[model samples]
Target: MLTRLLACTIAFAAPLAALAQTPPQVSPAVEASAPLEARIGELAQILAGKGDYDAYFAPAFRSQIPKEKFAQINAQIAATAGPMIRIESITPRTPWVADVTIGFRDAIGTVRISVAATEPHQVDGLLFSGLTPRVADMGSVRAAIAALPGRTGFALARLADGAPQMLLADHGDTPLAIGSAFKLVILAELVRAVNAGERRWGDMVTLDGGPLPGGQYMNVPAGTKVTLRELAQKMISISDNSATDILLKHLGRDRVEAMLAVVGIADPKGMTPFPGTLEIFKLKGVPGLADRYLALDPAGRRQFLDGEVARTPIAAISPTLFRDGKPVRIEQLEWFATPTDLIRVMDWLRRNSAAGPGAEVRAILGLNPGIPQPAAAKWKWAGYKGGSEPGVMHMTLLLEGKDGSWYALSSSWNNPAAPVEDVRFAGLVGRAAELAAPQP
Candidate 1:
């Protein structure tokens, strides 16, 4: 079931938004033609139904995504979000592309369709993003955020020229525990280094660290050689702890810190030596470690970490050891970021990051496309990265609309007394996405 969900979510390959120097503009007559509308309707019906939809697809698209693959995707969607109920709306963006809103029994979603504008219109590209219909209402978003079980922070911004317009915010400037979402900082730093010619993505690095039990590649031998690009993919895609630590070690703490400083992160001290999953687990596992670590100042904590690293091995600790401990000092040990600060980071990445590294980042983030992204059709491209531990949950998204505008949405939920309810938090974030959707 989980495998099918992942397959359905990550099935779509993002289309190149621009291929030619200037795309031919759609004329008003062509835009208003009944035939084009009928074609879109027919395609949507075929896609929403269970039977083979190959007749509607272009030869190239058919070859790329075969009949069996389409069936699997359909089945996965049904199993995960239920069958499609209706087609709410279809808006043509270009002669070749249209934004579609699809309703499922469980939720509403958007599908972006691009077709070859030839004799027989055929699908050239297809992408799905889950979205809620309430996204356009700021009051709805505010109500959702207010109803969350624990302390919550969120920021939604429209990425237009100059400054971002904040649509909704609740404690947006306050730093909170952001779990593995901090990986974005590492990714940004790596991209910066790559852009500056300090490192190549293909550079092979040996994975020499002790095995961390929390994520993928744990069973692989320590000395296995892999490209920096592969490590970055695993780190962001699966939240692979070993991959993160390896990349961090290769990039060095100083470089990441410098990157943070340049980005003007709010809580620089909280991230100086970002803790690997294993290190965090070890700290949680060792009795009395949390209290002692929290009692110290930043410098003292750094000294404590050095001692702990020297004294302990990851294999000796278990991730579940501190599960029973309530109100742990997660804020002090784990990564922290405010929604505003995170939005700034996303803005920088969207505007300044090079094309190659930016594409890679988006691909990695698009791997786990589970979050509800209400009004998904308005977005031309969407990528997401989220993180969670016992008491911390965080989500961040970078999105581009069909109109050539960009946006960023970030939110965090934290509760020291108990684990934050995952469903509730995700639902709220989804509502927030609805509010951040592009205005018609």
Candidate 2:
């Protein structure tokens, strides 16, 4: 499952979402002469690390995503999703746009691609979301996640009149570290503020400070004007830390903390003194700061983040803190939430995103439906948010089942002693999500 280049498909104008988003699955169906269908073979070669980049893509596609960057995205997919095996299906939306199901050694995946109508028929764009493991039902998915090392949790719930009817769960009440997934709270706060008339989606704010890694906003000049909608859109769609921190600051840190209870965090005190993105880097960068901060009660940590940690120079925060590609105080330093807690959070967003500037909330979440085709087709409407760190992995979704009922799936995996494999975790989560049955 590949997720970074999704926004690049068609006319890639917006900042892309996360780099590791994966989508859904389905049966085999091949069209012999659908125009764009012929290009699928070339895509297979490219994804398998053997295709010709210059010949398979148009200037427009090549210009936005350099050959090297394109290759890297494919390498990342192979690293996680395993090597490509074959094509399962190609369902064309148009001669230009189509959803193609692909088989990988570890999982089955669906990808969206757009091709040029003229000439050699080069690729215009492509979006890779996620992968679903070859499984018979949710039971197998739950078992696999349970067998994983360290802390792991999964929940399948049906939303009935604003409440969760637990359909299946494993460690559903245990809170685990959720990396960028914390942006959901920030989004909920933004919606609440807009609904209260405190701010408008059109409100523009000068981007504060420097951009951090893992985001396009990292390269954007500080102080560049950006709108609430743009920031929020980038935040969830790509889990942009820079956008998240700016929105967190603009909304007021304390207000966001207060929103925990409003959004059903279970234990609001667990996340009190919520730290912004920069604050997190500083906490990890400073020698022994994480252990000290973790040792303190929520109130004390808040004070440190507001005072000593707040004043820490940006230069002191080294990107090297995470360079080793290993967990760095994840348990003591990341956003905490349980499986059921996430269900409530998604429910809040689902019920409230129907009107006003808040109306755009749904679109933002669905900008990249972390799951693709056959599995994706299970829901009439779908939205996803996930987070990852060295030892922490999370995939959470808000889905409207085909019966017009709503459902939420929250899955998490954390290893305190080592790193968790991305592709394996994605396959497990994707299966449970695909098996979502609302009425039961």
Candidate whose lDDT is highest: 2
Model 1 agreement with the true structure over 231-323: per-residue lDDT tens digits? 888777666666777787789767877778666586687676566555666676567676787787867776777686547765454444543
Worst 10 residues of 1 by lDDT: 11-20
> Which stretches in model 1 have alpha-carbon errors above 4 Å?
1-136, 160-163, 315-327, 354-359
Cand. 2 TM to true fold: 0.81
> All models: lDDT?
0.65, 0.75
Q: Taking the tens digit of each residue's C-alpha lDDT, what string does model 2 give over 22-135?
A: 332332553334558778867777886688888888898888778876776676577657888899877766657677789988778767787888888788877665577777
Pairs that collide in candidate 1 are 130-373, 131-373, 131-374, 132-374, 135-434, 135-435
Q: Among these predicted structures, which one has the highest TM-score?
A: 2
